[model samples]
Target chain A: MSTLFSGQLLFAALVVGSIYVLIALGLNLVFGTMRLLDAAHGDIVMLGAYTSFWLFTLSGMSPLLSMLVAGALSAGFGAAIYYGLFRRLLANTQLSQRLEGNSLLLFFGISIILQNVAALCFDTTPRAYTYLDGIIRFGNVAMTGNRIAVLIIAAVLCAAAFLFLRFHIYGLAIKALIQHRQAAAVVGVNIERIQLLSFAIGFGLAGLAGSLLSMTEQITPFMGFPFTVAGFVTVILGGLGNLTRGMAAGMFLGFVEIYGVALTSPSLHSVLIYGVFIVVLFLQSQGLLGRRPS
Target chain B: MQPVPIRTSLIFVAVIGAASFLPQFGSEYVVAVALSFAMWVALAQSWTVLCGMTGYGSFGHAAFYGMGAYVQVLTWGTLSPWLSVPLAGLVSCLFALAAGYPALKVRGPYFVMLTFGLAEFLKFSIIGIEATLGQFSRLIIGAPSPNALYLAMLGLAAAATLITYVVSNSRFGYGLRAIREEEQAAETIGIPVARYKLTAFGLSAFIPGMVGAVMAMRLSYFEPSQAFDALISFNIVVMAMIGGSDDARGPLLGALFLIGLSELLWARAPQVYMIVLGALLVFFVLFAPQGLAKQLFGGARRRAT
Candidate 1:
C-alpha cells in the first residue's frame, strides 16, 4: 500500500497520462472541427506504432526520429482519407447534417480495413525494439530511460500543439470553425482547407503518440483499440472540443487508472477505466469542463 | 406500418424453408456456413428493430451476445441448452432493460460512444470476473451436433426476422421511427418516447442473445474475449447497413449477399474478405446509403406512396 502510493506511482501515472493527452487531443480536434467521430483514430495510432517499429527494425533509425516521420506519413494518409472518403460525404448537404453518424460508420469501416491490412502485412505477432533500455534513478524512484523519453517527447509534442492551437492564426481559425461553423465561414475561413488540415493533424498526433508509445510498450496491429477507448474517455471527461481541459482530464484519468490498478489488480485495469467512463457519461454528459448548452 | 408485402413474405418463407432442410442433406461444412448465415441474419435483423428504425445505432450488441454466451456457459451442466438458450435471452433482455434507460438518455454520437464504451466495459468486467475465478477459459464437452446447432440457429434466424417483421409494421415501430425522426416531437405527439426506445432496445437484444447461446454450443468453446469480440458488433452493423435496416427484407438480403461472398472468399483469403467488407461499407455509405434492399424494393414503396 505504501509503495503503491509512493512518488514512483505518481510519476508513472504522469507518464501514462501524457500519452493519453496526446491520444485525446487528436480525437477532440477532428470531432470539434468537422463533427467526425473518427472511429479509426485508434487504428491510426496502430499505423504510427508500426511505422516507428518498422523504421527502427529495418533501418536501425532511432525511434525519436522515426516518431516524426511516422507523424508526417500518418498526416498524409489522413489527408488522403479526407479527400477520398469524408470530402464526398461532406459535399452532400443532407448528409453533412448527419455527418457524425455517417462518419462514425465510415471510419469504423476504415478501422476494419486498417486493422486487417496491418495484420496481413505485419502479422499479428507483437513486436518491440530495444531503445534506451538503461534505467535512470532519482533520489528514491527509478525509471526506465525509454519511459522517461516517451514522457518528455509526448509532453513536448502536446505543448507544441497547445501553443499552435492557442496563438497561431490557423489555430484560431480552427477554433473559430468549432465554435461557429457558419460564422467562421462568413468571416473568410476556408472550411475545406481548415477541415482537411485539422483532420490530418488529428491523425498525425495519434500517429505521433503511437510512435512514442512504441518506445514504452510492445506494438501490435490490434493495440489501437484500447487507446481509442482511452482517448475517447479522455475526450469525454474533458468535455468534447475543449483541448486544455481534455489534457487535464487525461492526466486525471491516468492517475485514476494507475491508482485504481494498484488498489485492485492489473487485470481489472480496463474495468476501472470504463467504470469511470460510464459513470461520467451517465452523470455528466456535457463533460466536467464543458458548459451546458443554452 | 403497412403489412409486409405478400411477395416479400412468400420469398422469405421459401428461402427459410429451403434452408431448413440443409442439415439433413448438406455436408458438415455446409451446415457450419449455414449456421453462421443464420447467426448474422438473427443479429442483423434484431439490430434493425431498434437501431435501424429508431436511428439509435449501437456498437454494443456484442455485449448482449457475449452475455448470452456467458449465461449459457454458466448454465451448461445444470440446464439443457433448450432451457439455457431462452434463459440466455432472458438475461440479455434484463441487461438491456437495465442498461437502456441511461444509455438511451444520450443521443447520436454520444449514444454511439456510450454504447461502445459500455460493451467494452462489460467485456473487461467479465474478463476480470473470469480471472478472479481462476478460469481462463471454459470448454463445453459433448456439445450438440452441428446439425442440431444449425437447426437452433435457423430457428432463431426465423424468429428474429419474424419479430422484426412484426415490429416494423406495428404502432410500436411507428413510434420508434417517430422517435428517430424527432424524439421531442414524438413525445409531444403522445408517444412514450423513453418507453418506446427502451422496449425496442430490449426487443432487439433478445434474439442476439439466443444466437450467441447457439453459437457458443456450435463452437463448443467459451472464452470471455471470444464471446465479447467487438468484431461481432461491427459485423452486425455492417450487415444491417448493407442490407438496409428499414425493414426485415433488407437485412435478410444483406446477410445472404455478404454470407455468400464470405463463403466464396473466407477460407481462401480471409484478409481479402475483410478488406472487401470494409470497402463495401465505405462504398455503400457513400454511394447507396439507402442499401441494396431499398434499391430493389424501394421503388415499390415509393410508387405506393
Candidate 2:
C-alpha cells in the first residue's frame, strides 16, 4: 500500500495526467466556445501522431519539431471543418438543443471518416519510433528521457496556453463568447472569428498532445478514441467549458487512475477512470467545480 | 405522432411475412443479408423509442446489446436459448431501469457523454472481469442454425417495429414526444416526465438485448471487446438519424438502405463503405434532417425549430 503512493507512481501519474490535460484543454476550448462537443477531437490527435510519425520516418525530423508542424496542420484542418461544416449549424441560435444534438452527430460522422481514412491510408497496424530513449533518474525514481521530455514540454505548452487564455485580448474575447454568446457578439466580439480561432487552437492542442504521446507509446489509427474519452471525462469533471478546472480535474483523474490501477490491476485502469467519471456525473452533474443551481 | 394507417400496417405485415419465407427458399448469402437487415432494424427501432422520441441521444445502446450478449454467453448450455434470449432482454431492461435515473438527469450533450461513459465503463469492467477469470474469449458450441437465428432476429425486428409503432400512437409515446419537445413544459403540464423517460429508456433497451444475444449466437463467439464495440452504438445512431427516428417506418427504411449499401460496398472495400456512411451522415444531417422515410413516405414535416 505504501508502495502504491511511491514517488515513482506519483511521477507516472503526473506524466499521464499531463497528457490528459493536454487533450482536455482543446476539448474545453471548443465546448466552452461553441457548445459543440467535437467527438472527432481524438481523431485529430491520431492525425497529429501520424503526421509526426511520417515526418520522422521520411525526413528524420525530431518529434519536438513535428509537434509544432502537427499543431499547425491540425489547426488548419480545424478551421476547414468549422468553415465547411459547423458554420451553418452555429448560425441559428433558436435551436440550441438541436445545435448540440446536430453537432454531436456531425462530429460522430467526422470521427468515422477520419478513422476509416487513416486505416485505409495507413494500415491498421501499430507504428512506433525511438527518440530520446535514454534513462533519467532522480534519486530512487528512474524515468525515460522521452517521458521526461514529454513532462517538460507538456508543462510548458499547458502554461503557455493558460497564460494566453488568461491575459490575451483574443483570449478575453473567446471567454466572453463562452460566457454569453449573444452578449459577446453584441459587445463587438466577432463570433465567427473567435469561434474559428478557438476551434483551430483546440484542434492544435490535440495534435500537440498526439505528437507528445507518440514519444512514449505506440501509435495506431484507433488510439485517439481512448484519449477522446479521457478528454471528455476531464472536461465534464471540471464542468463543461471550464478550462482551468478541467486541467486540474485531468490531473486528479490521472492520480486516481494510476494509483487505482496500482492498487488493483493495470487492466482495470479504464474501469477506475470511467467509474470515477460516472460517479462524478451522477453526484455532480454540474461538474466538480461548477456551482450548484440555486 | 400520427396514427398508423391500416393500409400501411397491412403492407408491413405482408413484407415481413414474405421475408420470413426467405430462409427456406433464398440462398445462404441472401439469408445472411436478411439477418443483418433484421438485426439493424431491431437495434435502430428500439433506439428510436427512447432517443428519437425523447431527444436524449444516447450513445450507449451497445452497452445494452453487449450486456445481452454477455448474459447469453454466460448462460449458454446451462439454459436453452429459448429461455436465454428473452432473459437477455429482461436483464438489459433491468440494467436500463437501474442506469436511467442518473443517465436521464442530464440533457443533450451531457446525456451523450454520460451514456457513452457508462458504456465504456461497462466494457472495461467486463474486460477486467474476463482477464481475472483468465478467459479472453468465450465460444458457443452447438449454437442454433442461422435459419433459426434469422427467424428469431426477424421476429425481434417485427416486434421492435411493432413496439415503436404502438408507442408512436399511444399516450405513453405522446408523453415521450412531449418530453422531447419540451421536458420542463411537459412536466409543468403534469406529464410524469421521470417515469415516462425511464420506461422509454427501458423499453428501448429490451429489443437490442435480444438482438445482441441472437447475433452472438450467430457468430458462436463472444469476446467482451467485440460484444461491446462502440461502433455498434455509432452505427445504431447513424441508422436512426439517416432513416429518421421519429417513426417506426423510418428505422425500417434506414436499416434496409444502409444494409443494402453496406452489402454492395463492404464486399469489395469495407473502408469505402465506412467513408460513405460517415459522409452520408453529414449529408443527411445538413440536407435531409428529416431522413429518407420521412422524405419518401411523407410525414409531419419536421418542426423547423
Candidate 3:
C-alpha cells in the first residue's frame, strides 16, 4: 500500500512537472540565447493547444499527429515573427541598443494580436481531446494513458534538447550568438539565420507542450496569461541563460504545485510557486543558477 | 519672455471643464466608462514617470494598483474613498520602495523582467490568500456616492499631473534624467543612482495605487483577478508610450485617445479590439517611436531651431 501510494504521488508530480519543464525550456532557450523577452511565448503554447484541438475535432486526426502539426505551424509562425519583426528591428542597430525601448512595445503588441486572433478564431470555450480516454492503473495508483504518453514525450524532448545544445553545430552557433553577438558575427556566424532557427525551435517546443497539456486538460485562448506568469517564474527560479537550470526549476515547480494542491487548496498552488520564486530571487539576486553580477 | 502658450492653457481648461460636467449629461454607463478612462489616465501617467523619464520600464504597474485597491478594500471599504484612496497610494509607494531596492540593481530587460515577476508573484499571492480567507468575491465595503467618488478621482488625477510636472522640473528630475541617460556617467558625477531610482519608482507606484483605490470605490467591488489583471498593465504601458513618456501631457493624451478608441472599438467589434490595439502599438513603435506628443511638439522645437 505504501509503495503504491508513493508511486502514485511521484507519478502525479512527474506528469505535472513535465508540462512545466517543457514550457520553461522554451522560454529559457528564447531568453537565454536571443536575450529577447518574448512575452508571446505563452501565447504560442496557447495557439498550439487550440490548433491541435481543432485538428483533432474537425479532421478526426490522432492527437499525436495533431501535436506534430500544431508544433510545425507554431514554428512557422515564430519564424515569421523573427523575420518580420525582430530581424527588421535588429537590422542597422548595435547589439546593446537592440534590446531596449521599442522592442518591448513591438513584442507586447504582437502578444495582443495573437491573443485576439485566437479569441476570434476559437470562441472563448474551454476545449479538450475527448476521444483519448481510459485510466491506467497500477495497484492503487491511477492515471490516464495520455498523461503517461505526455510524460514520455516530455522526457525525450528534454533529453534531445540537452544533447543537441551540447553537441549540435546549430546549437553551438546559437550559444555563440548568445555569449557575444558581435563577436559571433565577426567569426562568420550567420547571426540572423541562427536567430530565426532558435526562435522557431523555442516556440515549437511551447507548441508541443500546449498540445500535450490539451490531452489531459482543457484549453482556453486566455490560458496564455497564466502560463506566461508560470513560465517566467520557472525560468527565473531556474536562472536566466541556463537551459539545464530551467528544466530543473520547472520540475521543482511542478512538484511544488502538486504538493501545494494536495496539502492545501489547488488555488494556492500558483501562489506557492510564485512565493518560492520570490524567496529564491531575494536569496540570490542573480537567480538560482545565474552567476554573480559583473 | 512669452507667456506659456494661452492656447494650450485654454484648451486644457476647456477639456477639464467639459470633463467635470460629463457625469451630469451622460447616462450611468457613459459615466462609468469615462470614470474608467480617468483611472487609465492616472495609471498611465504613473507608469510614465518611471518608464518614460527614468528609463525603467516597469511591466508591473498593475501590481501596485492592485495593491492599492486591496489595501483600501480590506481596511476602509468604500465609505470614504477620498481619504482611503490616498492611503492606498501611500501603501503602494511603500511596497515599491521595498520591491525596488533589490530589483533596481539590474538594468535594461532584466529590470523589466524582474518587475514583471514581482507583479505576477503579488497577483498570485492575492488570489491564494483570498481563496483561503473566503474573500475571493467580496464587493467594496461601502457604497459611496458615485458623484463624490468621481470628483475625488478627478482631484487625484489633477494632483498626479501636478506631481509629474514638479518632478519634470525639479533637481531630482535632473538626476533621474542623468541616470536614464547613462547610469555609469551619473555615478561618476556623484549622483546617487540607486536612491533616485528608488524614489522615482516609489512615486510611480503612488499615483496608480491611489487611482486604483478610487476605482474600487467607483466599481464597489474587488476580486483578485480583476484587481490584478495584466491587461491593465498592458493598457497603461501602451497609453503612456503612445502619448509621450517625457512630458506630463503625453500620458494624459495617450490615455484619453486609447480609452476612447477602446470604447468605440468595443462597441463596434469587441473581439477585434485587441488586434487593433496590437496593430496600433506596432505602428507607433515602427513609425512614431517618439509618440504622438513628441510628434505634435517636436516639430515646434525643430522650427524654433
Candidate 4:
C-alpha cells in the first residue's frame, strides 16, 4: 500500500530479475544457436549452486571466489555433455524425422540423471550462505546487500555478454549459426567448436546465476526444474535465443512474482507467473524483442 | 510392404487381451503393478497418438492426468469416482480442445515449451486454489478399493491402445503422419491440418484424464503438489521416447519394461531406480533412437511405394 514498500518491491524485482536474466542468458545462447531444447539447463544451474555451496562450506571460500569455481564446474560439465552426449545426437541427423524427439528426450534424461545425482550428493537439504548479513537502506526503502551484489554482478555480466555477442568474432559466429546453421557451416564457421563454446558459456552463466542464488534463497536439488521453467520462460519470452530480450522478460517476471506474492499472498505467485507465462507464449511466441528466425 | 503383415496386429491384440485378464492369474501385488503398467501404457500411447505421429514432443502431457485427478478431488463427496472418471476425460477433452488452438500454433521446438507452460499453468492454478483455501482437505469419493480401480484402469488402457491402433491404421492416421513429416507440405496437400491435430490432441487427452481420476481414487487423498507432480509428465515422455514413439507396440513394451523395473527397483531405492532409468533413456536416445517395433519390424516400410 505504501510508496516505500513499492520501492522495496521494485528493488526486489531488480535484484531477482537480474539473477533470473543471468540464469536464462546461457539458455538463450545454447538454445538459440544450437537449437537443442536443453531441458537439463536448469539442472546445470542447480549443480552450479551445489558446486559453490560445497566449496564455500568445506573449503571456506568467499562467495565471490566460489562463483568462479561454480562457473568452471558447470562449463566443464557442459563441454563434457556436448562431447559425450550431444555430439552423438548431432551426428545422427540422418534419422531426420526422429531428430527433434531424440534430442528432447536425451535432455530430459540428462535432467533426470542430474536431479537424482544432486539429491544423492547434496542430500536434498535446502541451503543458503550468509556472506552479507545486513540490509542497505535508502530513505525509507531497504534491500539486502546479497541482493545488491547479485544485481551488480548480473547486470555487469549481462552487459558484457551483450557486447561480446554483438561485436566479438565468436559472437558473430554464434549469430551466423543461429541465423543459418547450414550456411554458416558451408562458410567454414567451425560449427562444432562454436556450438561447444556457446554451450559451455551458456551453462557457465546458469551456474553463475545459481551461485548468486545460493546467497539469497535455500538451494535444493528440487529447485532446478522450477528454475528450468523460469529459465525456459525467460528465454522464450525474450524471443528464443535473444539474451537481451530474455533479460527484459526476466525483469518483468520478477516484478509480477515479487509484488503478486508479497502484496496479496505468497501462494498466488506460481499462478501469476505461470498464467503470464502461458499467455505470453500464446500472445508473443516471437518474444518481446525478437524478430522471427526466418 | 507386402500387404502389411497381419501377424503383428494379432500379437498386439493378444497383449492387450492378456493384460485385461491379468487380475485373474496374478496376485494382488501383480494386479497393482499391472494396473500401473496399464496406466503408463495409456498415458504413453495417448502421448504417442498426438506427439509421436505428429512430431510434436509434449513435455507436459501430464496436464490431462492431473486434470482427471483434480476432477475426482472436486467431485469426491458427491459423485462416485467411477462416474466422475468419464467426466474427468470430458474436462480434459475440453481443455485440450481449448488449449490446442493456441498451443498448436507454437512452431517447431517451441511446441514443447508451450505444452509444458500450459501444464505448469494448470498445476499452479491448483496450488493457488489450495493456498487460498489454506489446506488440502481430503475429498473421498467412497471406500478405497484397489481391485475396482485396477479393473477400471485396465479398461481405460485397453481403450486407449485400441484407439491408437485404429488411428494408426486409418486415413486420419496417415494425415497425422503427413503433418509430422512436414506441416507446410501437408497443408499444401489439402489436409485439414488444424482439425487433424486437434482431433489427435483430443484423443490423447481422453483416456489419461480418466486414468488420472482412477489414480486419485486409489491415492485416497489429494494435494496439488502430489496430484499434479511434474514427474508424471517426465516419466510418460521418457518412456514413450525410450520405448519408441513411432509406433504403439514400441511404447507399450517400453511402458511395461519401465513401469515393471520401477516397481521392482523402487521398492528399496527410488533414487537408484530413477538414475538407472535416466541412464537408459540417454543410452537409448544415443544408441537406439529407433522404436523397438521398427528395430524388430523395420522402419517406415513405404519403400517408395
Cα lDDT tens digits for candidate 1, B1-305: 67668998898889889998987888888888888988999999999998888889898999999999999999999998889999999999999989998789888877887888899899999998898899999988889878888889999999998998898889997888888887899999899998899999999999889888988898888999989998788788788778875668888888998899889998899888989899989988888887887788765121000
Query: Any runs in candidate 4 off by more than 4 Å, and if so which?
Result: A95-101, A182-188, A286-289, B1-25, B134-141, B299-305
* Tens digit per residue, CA lDDT, model 3, A245-273: 78988898878777777777666766676
**What lDDT does candidate 3 reach at residue A222?**
80
Question: Can you tell me the DockQ of model 1?
Answer: 0.59
lDDT of 4 by residue, B120-159 (tens): 8888887777777886656564656687788888888878
lDDT string for model 2 (A202-287, tens) is: 99999999999898889888899888878877877788777888889999888888888888887777788788777877756644
Q: What is the lDDT of residue A226 in candidate 3?
A: 66
Which stretches of candidate 2 lie above 4 Å from their native place?
A93-97, A286-294, B1-4, B301-305
Better of 1 and 2 by DockQ: 2
Please report, in order, the local distance difference test score of every candidate based on alpha carbons: 0.87, 0.88, 0.78, 0.80
True contacts kept of each: 0.73, 0.70, 0.62, 0.66
* Docking class for candidate 3: acceptable
- Tell me the deviation in Å of residue B174 in model 1: 0.9
- Among the numbered candidates, top lDDT falls to 2
Pairs clashing in candidate 1?
Answer: none
* Local accuracy of candidate 4 as per-residue lDDT tens digits, A225-280: 87777777787777876666788888977877787777767767777777776777
Between 3 and 4, whose TM-score is larger? Answer: 4
TM-score of 3: 0.89
